[model samples]
Structures are given as C-alpha cells and as structure tokens.
Target: MTEFVRVLLPLAPAVPLVLALLGLLLRRPTSLLPLAALPGLAAAFVSPTGEIISLPWLLLGISFRLDPLGAVFLGFASLLWTLAGLYAYAYLGGKQGEGRFCLFWNLTLAGTSGTFVAADAATFYLSFALLSLAAYGLVVHERSKAAWRAGRVYIVLAIFGETCLLLGLLLGANAADSLLIDDVRAALAVSPWRDAAILALLMGFGLKAGLVPLHVWLPLAHSAAPVPASAVLSGVIVKAGLIGLIRFLPIDALPSWADTLLWLGLATAWSGILLGLPQRQPKAVLAYSTMSQMGLMVAVLGAGFGAGVAGTTMATALYATHHGLAKGALFLAVGVVAAGAGRAAIPLLVVVAVLGAAIAGMPFTGGALAKLAIKDSLGSGPVGLLASLSAIGTMLLMLRTLVLLVAQRPPAAVAHASAGLIGPFVATAAAALVVPWLLFPVLTGRPLAYAFASPVIWDALWPIFVAVVIASPAFLRSIAVGDIAGPVEAVLRRVGGSWTAWHPPRPAIDGPRLLTRLVKPAQSLETWLAGSAASGSALLLVAVLLGFAALI
Candidate 1:
C-alpha cells in the first residue's frame, strides 16, 4: 500500500512535467494536455495522507507526502489547473501561441500541484521555484508590450522572493539538521536564528502571496496574462506563499507574532478591496480582489495562531480552497462574458453573479462554507468583526467587477463562442458550489445541516445586503496599498525620467569643445614632455603633495 501510494504521489507532478517536455516537439497536442492534470487531481483524492515518499538521489534529497493540509491545497490547485487547461485548449484553439502556451501551462501545473504534496524543504523550494520561473512564459505569452512589462515585474520580484526563500530554507535546514520540512518546522521553535528565518520566510512567501506593498505584480500580470493563465495565477499560484507559511512557520511555538500576522492580514484584505473598487476592468478588479482575499486568509491564519486554536490549519486550507475555485471561475468567466453577447451572455452572467456573491460570502454558498469553517477559530471578537467587514468590501469589489463585465461587448478577436469554452466555466462554477458542501461536514466535524441553519444563513446574507445597499445610489454610487507597489509599478519604468530629463548642463565640467577651439598645444611642449625635464617636474609635484600632506 505504501509503495503504491508513493508511486502515485510522484506521478501526479511527473505526468504533467513529462508532457510539458514532450509538448515542445508535438504539433499542438492541446486536446490531450488537459489530461496531464488528471494525475494530480487523482492524487488529491486517492493518495493517502501521511504516506511520505523520499527521493534520496534527487537534488539534495527531496520528499513528498499528502497531509490533510496538503490535500486541500492539492485538491483545489489540481482542480483549478485541470479546468483552466481545458478552458485554455478551447479558448486558444487555432490561435498563434497555442503550442507555446500549452508548454508553460503544463509546467506551471506541475509545479503548483507539486508544492502542496512536497515533504521536504528541497522539494518545496524546487517546486516553488519552477512554478515561479516557468510562469514568466505564461505571463509574456502574448508578447505584447504590456505582457512583457508584466512579465518583467513578475520575474524581478520572483527572483527576489527566490533569494529570500533559499536563505530561509538554508538557515532552517541547518538549524534542524535535516532536509525534511517537518524537521525544519520543528526546529523553528528553538532555533537560535528563529527570528531571521521567520522574517525571510514571511517576505519570500508574502511576495508570492500578493500581500500588500509586494502586490503590484498581481494587477499587471493578471491584466496581461491570457485568461487561462490569469485563472491559474490568481487562483492557484499565489497560494504557494500561503502554503509555504502553513508548512514552515512555527506559529505554534512563536505565538507572539500572531497579532502581527493578524493585523498585516487585515491590512492586506482591505487594501485589495480599496484598490479594486476603482478598477475599470474586470480583470484588474479581480486582481485586487485576489490581494484582499489573500490578506483575509492570512488574517485567519494569524487569528487562529493567536487563539492557539486546533483548526487553524484546516480552517485556512478550507478558505484557500474555496477562494481558489471561486476566483478561478471568475477569471475564466471573464472570457466567457466577453465571448457571449446580448441574451446569450445572460445565463453566463447569472453564473458570474453566483460566483461573485460566493466570493462575498453570500448565504448558502461556497464563501459561506469558508466563513463557517473558520468562524469558530476566529470567534466573535474584533478580528472576526474585521473579517466580516472585509466581506462587505468584497461584495462591493465583486459588484463592480460584474458591472464592468456586463458592459463589455463581444470582442471579435475570440472565436465564436463554443461549448468547449463555456463548459469549463460552468463546470468550475458547479464544482465551486457542490464540492465544498460535500466536504464541509467531514472537515469541520459538524453536521452539514449546521451550515444551513437560519441564523447561519442570516449572518451570511446581511453582508451581501449591506454591500448591495452601499452599492445603491444612496451609498456606493461611486464606490471605491501598503499596496502602493502595484499602482506605482508603472512609475518604475520611468525611474528618474522627469528628474533626468534633458536639461541644459550646469557647467559642472570643463568642456572639450572649448578646449578644441583653442590652438593646439605646441609640438615643442610634447617634445619637451618626452625629455627628463617633464619626468623631473612630475616627480617633484608628487614629492611636494606628499610633503604638504604630511606637514598638514
């Protein structure tokens, strides 16, 4: 049994990875590419949790296992990748970059799916690195100027994040005296360099998670990346950092930092909403929403940490899983909304409304399931209150996104809409709606009916009502970065542009033009300089300067 599970675990990532390599030579085998994610999705369900497998010969000894925590990450990440791959195949059929897109798309899927199941620092780092680096291809796949710009920002920040992660892993593994992730985390409780290691881990993961100040990349990247790539980027890839923190941060040992993480999470949550509300495009709006949702997830982790709750890990995983499905669906729907026009778009739009509302924690939906799963850990305290408030902001952000999307006309660039394209969007929406409800009872150890009780339903509804009221003319008619980095990324391009604009020189140096106009120095001077007279004068000058300095 153990051997069978081990083989299956590695096959999850290996299948897609091999496909990615083979895709280079194949003639646009996109239809078959969607199956690459099948192994990962199967792993999420079939691979027994805690059945760890080690590859001693592979890159400093890497290992993999699927714990309860990993299952959630793997389940959602794999599901999103599968659906997005399917959508991409249909969306880009006969398009120019289909072959190139398929290659990176599978590569990214392999990395993301691997991160969840990774059991050692080496495996996690390499998987995380592959996801981070290979995604550059997806971002710049369009080869547009904007695509290139987003790719540049994504890569630059990605490199910095890699450095921080490597440092943290090195210090952590050294302290633990083991390459296994569990051992490293266990050592974090008492390691002499705990603070340094934690700081590096947070920065490295936080940057990828799109936390405030480091989040500028999300907006540009999402807006520029193709719809399928954007779906995975926002949906699954960003969660890499969150999972890293979950795996490595010794939150149980260093509970002192709980409030710190909590506040940072809240700040990120609201920052995303504030920035997203003003966005004119659905993609940009969703990008900021990703930031806010990620922040709230962090805040949940922190709150659970501070409270010393048992379910912190599970609660966070649940939240991330829910967000991944809903957000991915929303991004993919961007394509659906643009492709479906007039009356045809109405059903798709309705699905969008449900998914958006679910994001806002609407009652009896996936977001409600997420909120319910976490509320026990959060309690009815200030942090919970703040989290609830952020839901209102999310409601507004989604409402804005819906409005913007509704306004888009059918773009001619897309092939006339097909079932292949719309099917994935609908399937994702259905999965987002159905899967969690099925899992909630088992994960929370509560009756499924507990979620749908009248009071529980009301708690979810009020936020949606409040948000809608605010969106009304009376309140949110013109509704809305620690997150400053995303908005100012454009300014990075013109660094020193205005300050260094070509201004007349202030005569800081003697000009060659002035000297050139003067008659050339006599050839005699050159002749004399070649003699001992010039050499003696130069030597005397050096001697005088030395004597003068010594005297002074």
Candidate 2:
C-alpha cells in the first residue's frame, strides 16, 4: 500500500509531462487538457503523510518524497493547474495560439508539481529549472513585443536565480558529501560555509518568490502572460520559491542571520503593497499583491527560524496553501470580469470582492485562517506589529484590484462569457472559499470554533476596517500607487541608472548620434578600401595566404 502511494509521487509529474509532449500532436483544443492535473490531485490525498521513495537506478540515486509539507504545496498546485487548464479550454478556444499555450501550460504544470516531490538536490534543481524555463514560453505566448520583452526579463532573472541555487546546492552537497536534501540540510547545520550557503539559497529562492529588489520581472511577466498562465504563474509557480525556503532553511534551529531574513521578508511584503497601489491594470495590481503576500510568507518562515518551533513549518506551509488557492482564483476572476458585462458581471464581481477581501484578512476566509496560523510564529514583538500593519496595506491593495476589475467590463457589443470560462472561474473561487475551511482542521489540528471565535475574527477585521477608513476620502479611494512604484522602486531605478551611467558598455552603445559617428567612420573606411588598389591587394594577399594554408 505504501509503495503504491509512493508510486503516485513520480506519476504526478509524469502525467503533465506526457500531456505537454502530446500537445505537439494535438490538432486543436481538446477535452483531454485538464486531465493532466488528476494524477497530482490523487497523489495529494494518497501521500498526505509523505514517504521517501528511492530511485537508485535513476540519476546516480534520484529520490522523490511526499511529506505533509510538500503535500500542501502539491495539493494547491494540482488544484490550480486543473482549474486553469479547464479555463484554458474555453479561454483558448478559437484562439490563434492554442497549441503553443497548451504545450507550455502542461510543461509548467509538470515542473511545478514535481518540485514539491523531489527529495534530492539534483532532482529538485532539475525540477526548479524546468519550471523556470518552461514558464517563459507561457509568458511570451501572445508573441507581442511586450510579451517578448517580459519573457526576456523573466529568462534573465530566472537564469541568475538558477545559478545561485546551483552554487548553493553544490556548496551544501560538498559539505555534506551527500545529494539527498535531508542530508544536505543536516550537514548545513554545522557547515563552515553555512551562512554563505543560506545567503545563496535566499537570493535564489527570493528572486523566484518575487522578493523586493529582485521582483521587477514579476509584474511584467504576470501581466504579459495569457490569463490562465498568469493565474498559475502567480498562484502556483512562485510557490516553488516558498517551498524552497521551507525545505532548505533550518526552521528548527535559529541561525545568526535570522533577523536579517525577517527584515528582508518584511521589506518585501510592505514593498508589494506600496507598489501595487497606483496600478490601473487589475492583473498588475494582483501581481504586486502576490509579491506582498510572498513577502509575508517569507517573514513567517524567518520568524519560524528565529523561534525554532516545530509547528512553524506546518503553519508556513498552510499559509502558503491558502494564499496560493485564493490568489489563483482571483487571477482567473480577472478573466471572467473582462468577459462579463452589465447585469451578468454583478455576481462575478461580488465573488471577486470577497476573494480579494480575503487576501486582506477579511473575516471568515482563507486569508483570515492563514493569518491565525502564523500569529504565534509572528509573536508579540515589533515584527508582529509590523506584520499586522502589513495587512492594512494588503487591504488597500485589494481595494485597488477590486476597482480595477470592476471597471474592466467588456464593451457593450461583446457577448457574455461562455460557461466553459465562467465554470472554472466560479469553481476555483468556490474552492478558495471552502477548501481552506476543510483543510484547516487537517493542517492546524484546530477546531472550527477557534477559526470563527470572536477575538480572532476581530483581529482579522480591524486591518480591513483601518484600510476602509483611510480610503474613505473620494479622491484617496481612486488613488493608484502602481504607476511610479513607491520609494523603494524609485531608489532601485535610480541606483541602477547610476551604475549603468558609470559603466556604460562601448560595444553595445545606442543612440543615433553615436551610431552615426561610428557608422560614418566605418563608411569612410569602406569607401577608402573600395577606392584603394593597395587595400585590395592586401586583402587579396590575406585571402591567398589563407587559401594556401587551407590547401596545405
């Protein structure tokens, strides 16, 4: 029975991989697309307790596992993929790039699901790399200039992140003399270069998680991808980094750099909220919100590291699971709103409001539960207060997302969204609402009474109340902070510009004036060469010498 359960771990990733390859032969949109997620969803239930399965014949000794922590990630990843795949069926129907979309979609799905199950360093790296690389195709699927530009930025950052992870993994592996993740982590506890390894891992995973300063690619990439692709990319793929932080970082032991991590996480969280405020685009606002939410998760993980509590890891994973589902559903809702109009748009907008508000820690939602789970970890320190304040920011950001989404109705001439599109959208939103409630008991071992209790409910509601009070001014309500990101982004851009100005590359110089100068010299040389018999004789001599050398 155990072996059968473990078998599903590998099979989970295998399903989508096969589908991605088969997409090449697919003549058109087919019903078979969403089935790719079934295996993973099955594995989530079958291996909730997790079992380490070895594949000695595979790669020197590749291994896969399904611990409870990994199961949380796998469950949400599978659910989001299934819903997104369903949405794509209708979303991409009659679309010009359906084939390209399906191929990349399945590829990304395989990599994301596999990342959670990888038990060894090599397998994890391979899985992470696959996810990073394959997602680019989705980012650029529209083939527009903006899409291509976003893809370029995404690939560049992804490659840098991969390099950091590879080096970190190599360093840890060398210290431990083992390829297994468990062993490497054990070795890292006492390794001489442990801090360096941690720093590298943080940089690598933080980049993927859209941590501030490394998050430039996120908004551009999320907004550029197709709606379904954006949903999963923001919701599921980014969690790869969160899981990395969970697995690699020593949550059970307090490290010297724990404070630094906590600060970094807080910065990332607040930065997202501040930057997301000005955006008019619903998708972009949501993208920044993701960055903010990820920052909070990072902060929670850092808090766990500081406290060295056993439950912190589980809490972090549960929080991530909740955020992943809700965020994914909201992105999908962005599509529904775009397709809806007049009276048909009302219910969808209401659902969107509830879901968006949930991210703000609205009462009786997954976001509220997520906050409760992490409360103990955050503790009663200044960090805790800051974390609470961050919720207000989240509320403000969600308000912007709601307004943008509501204002995005299709033209009067457009048709109502087909059932195919609305079906997945509504299904995902329902899951976001109900699934978290069902899993709360399993994840926290806490009763529904605790979740709905007066104190916890009020704690969740206050932040939202504060946000509304602040935004009550009519002008302030419409204020968007997205266009010129807050102080952090402004500072980053200034610093980057200064660095570039200080060290401009000669070979890659641009501007028509410089080009004209360089081209004029080249043109003059060309004319001189054409006019001069001596130059021609010299060229002929060089060619003759080269020909002679070749003959010899």
Candidate 3:
C-alpha cells in the first residue's frame, strides 16, 4: 500500500467518530450528518485489496486491512450510510432529538465501517459492539411507546447476539493462540470446542442477520425506527452479521456447518415472506423483506462455502452491495410516498416498481447480477430451484408493499414531494441500478453477456410473472408485525394489566411505608442503573460473562 492509502485506512472510521463528537457540541441539523461519513466514502475507493495498516499503540495492537470482501463492504456501506444520513436531514431536520440521532447515527457509521476493516479480533469486537449499542438511540429516537418497546427488544437481542459473538471470538482466538482474525478463523476448524464455537457464532450472527426464529426483534425494530434509521438497519447494519459469518466461519474446513446454515437460511427466506405477507405497515413489510433478503445472502454463503468455491466472499459481497443500495432506496421511497410526493408520487411509484423488480432478480438489473454471482454454488438441483422460487415470493411481497404504499399516497391537490428527500433517494436508487454492472465483472470475473442470455432472462422473468398472477387483494392479511413475539407480548401485557387492575390487598401501608423508606436508597440505585447509559455498560458486562462462559 502507498503511504497515503495506509494513513487513510484508519482515518476512515476515526474521522466520522471524531466529527460525531464535534457535531454534538455544535448541534448541527440532521442534513449535516452526511458530511461526517465523507471520509469513509473516500477510503472505500482507495482501499487496495490485501492492504494492511497496523496501529500497535491502539487498543491491544489493532490492525486494519482491505481485502476484496472488505473493499466491497466498505464502499457500498459508506455510500448507503451517507445517503441515508442526508435523507435523515430531510426526514427529521431541526427536530427535537436531532442532535442525539445524529450522534448515534455517526457512531453506528463508525462502528460498521470499523467492522469491515479490522484485522484483529479485539478491534472487530469493539467495532461490532459500538455498531450494535449506538443503534439503540436511532431505534427509539421518537421516544413513543412503540419506539421504546422496540428499543427494549432490540437492545436485549443485540446484547444476546454480541454475547454469542464475543464467546465465539474468544474460543477461536484461544484455539488459534493468536489475536489475528484470519488465524482465529483458521483455528476454529481445529479447536477442541469447535462445535460449541460454531453454535455460539450461529446463534449470535444468525440473530443479527434475522435467520428464521432469531428474527423476532427485526420487524418490530424496523417498523418503530424513523425512515432513515430503518433504511440503514435493514440495508447496512444486517450486513455486519453477514460479514461475520463470511470472515470467521471457515466454511471450507467444515462443510457440515455450511449445510446447517443452508437449511437455516432457506427457512428464514420462506418464513420472512409468509410473515411479511400479513403485515399492515409498509415499513413492517419492508422489515420482513430485509429478513428474507438476508436469508438469501446466507443461503448463498452456505452454498458457496460448502462447494469450496473460490471468491465466494467477493460474490456474496457483490450480492450484498446490490441489495443494500436497492433496499435502502426502496425504504427511502416509502418515505417519499408517505410524505405525499404530490405529482411525483406516481413517478416515484414507477421507480419503486423497477426497484422491486431489481430486488426480485428481474433481467437486466442489479439483482440479476447478484443472482448470477451465486448461481453456480446453488447448483441446478432442487436447492437451486427452491432458491429461485424465493424470488416469486419476494416479488409478491414487494407487490403487496407497493399496493400498501399506493394506498398511502395523498390526493394530488394536497400532496407535494419534499425536495430534500429526492436528492438522496435518487442517488441511492441510481447507485443500485448502476453499481452491480460495474462490480460483477471484477468480483466474479464473468462477462456481463451471461446475464443477458435468453435462458437467464427467462429464468428471472418467470418468477416475477408468477408472482403477479398469484398476487390478489383477497389473499392479503395483516398479522401483527412481531411474529412469534406477538402472542408473547400480548400475554405479558395482559398479565401486567391484570396486576394493575387487581392491586393485591395491602395492609394499612403504615408498616409498608417503613419498609419503603428503608429501601429508598436501594430504589435510587436501581433507578440509576436503569438509565440508558448505565444499560449500555451493563451490556458490555454481559458480553464479558458470555465470553468467560465459553472459556469454561
């Protein structure tokens, strides 16, 4: 690496983090949030594959590297975050809590960017922790009852995921007898506790990636967050879990594990569609769309890994990039329609149609490229056919989502597209349209001509046609967003209400008052511990314990 690139590597994540603190002091509007992410974007372009930059002075001798996979993740993620940040300005500029939102937004940006580059386990964990924890602010930025509830579920699941991840990392590192990420991943295959480590990793990263049963928090969190936050949560943040699986799982060394992931991912893919079909909220449907898309990503990962395919990382990264840009744009488009894009709502819907097609892998779009990148690994057997059928389900979901969004469009006379939303939204949409063609050849080393072949085009087109034919208003159902958690939440609420309605018979609170007075100080301590900042520290403590559990 050149001296310039070497210096630029660490600065990518560091710059935004420093600016985030400064922005907090300055109290900038939401629009300025995009400026903080600029450096990371610049680094993305110059990130040379196989380049490494070490900072021995940093926490436990951290190192950063830009391999092919890292480069793709960093570049596209930076793009999504920056655009989403600008869109946030339009969505919530000068609003109350804008400062807090900006802080956590940039902090999450730093954390995610760091995760893409870190070469050491400690650096990766810290970055992942920052990404996981700071995002809570975004989830609850509105502070409404729903937002708080979502925040609670998100933080709990986040802590759980991180705990599993931390323990897995520790086990891998201990087995490797090295702190380096590559060393630890290689050692996982040889570890005495290999099965336990892999289980921990799947539980942790699987939760973040929204794989099947672990996806309870996702739909609720996305629907509860603000538009821009939901965009990142779905598009950029989930990729953190994906990259974890790619970087650490050692798929080539353990084919059985890859097979396990294959089935798990397939289950998530189908389930997300089934559950999302019933969602009333547009964002909730998109949230489930994200879960399903993530399932596709992992499914591809498992197939490629099991096949011992070269360049699986790059191909998976390519798919991720395509999905991120398109899905992020789709979410922003929801905001535009919700804002009553006036005359533009129709035009925006046209764009949404095309975006949805891209997501469903229609011919001549980025999604097609993504599908092509992973096609060989999925093989031509039943597995491949089943995976292809997922496209039909995805298209149907998007079709329903479109119907919901159109229902939301305001009357032309009363509606007008907000100018601020258009710029970022268009940029994101354009990137999704254009970036895949640029990356596919480089990533997969395949000619673009393959994507346009008649067979390929027909294969992509049939599912979409089927989806259209099968879609009907009569079939739509709005199952409350939380899936399995829905009934559980209802039970808890019912029980709590019952307790409130039937207060236990209290003895003349004279004696109870004395008891309360004695524990008032304890209550005060409890209150202190309940604050958000304290909760975050407590999260870290839990991770440490989880790691220790692995060692034992």
Query: Could you give the C-alpha RMSD of every candidate to the true structure, in order shown?
Result: 13.1, 10.9, 6.7
Candidate 1 local distance difference test against the native? 0.80
Candidate 2 residue lDDT tens string, 244-270: 987886645645566777888899898
Instruction: Show where candidate 1 strays beyond 4 Å.
Output: 1-4, 411-415, 472-552
| Top lDDT model | 3
TM-score for each predicted model, relative to the true structure: 0.86, 0.86, 0.89
**Candidates arranged by lDDT, highest first:** 3, 1, 2
Which digits, one per residue and each the tens of the lDDT, describe model 3 over residues 1-552? 577767777987897788778777765556567876676777778756676688989866778988878888888998998999889988888778888888888889889999999988999999999999999998998898678768876787788788889999999999999878899999999899999999998888888899866687889888998999999999999999999998888877788999999888988999899889888778988899899989988988888889887777788899899999999999999888887787677788898999998999989999899988888878888889989999998998888889889887877777566788988999999999999999999999999998989999999899999999999964465566766653444433444457857886455467988767746754453443333231234234434433343344
Cand. 2 Cα-lDDT: 0.79
Off by over 4 Å in 2: 1-4, 472-552
Candidate number with the higher lDDT (1 or 2)? 1
Instruction: Check candidate 2 and list the clashing pairs.
Output: 50-66, 277-481, 278-480, 278-481, 278-482, 279-482
For each candidate, the alpha-carbon lDDT, in order, equals 0.80, 0.79, 0.83
- The clash tally of candidate 1 reads 5
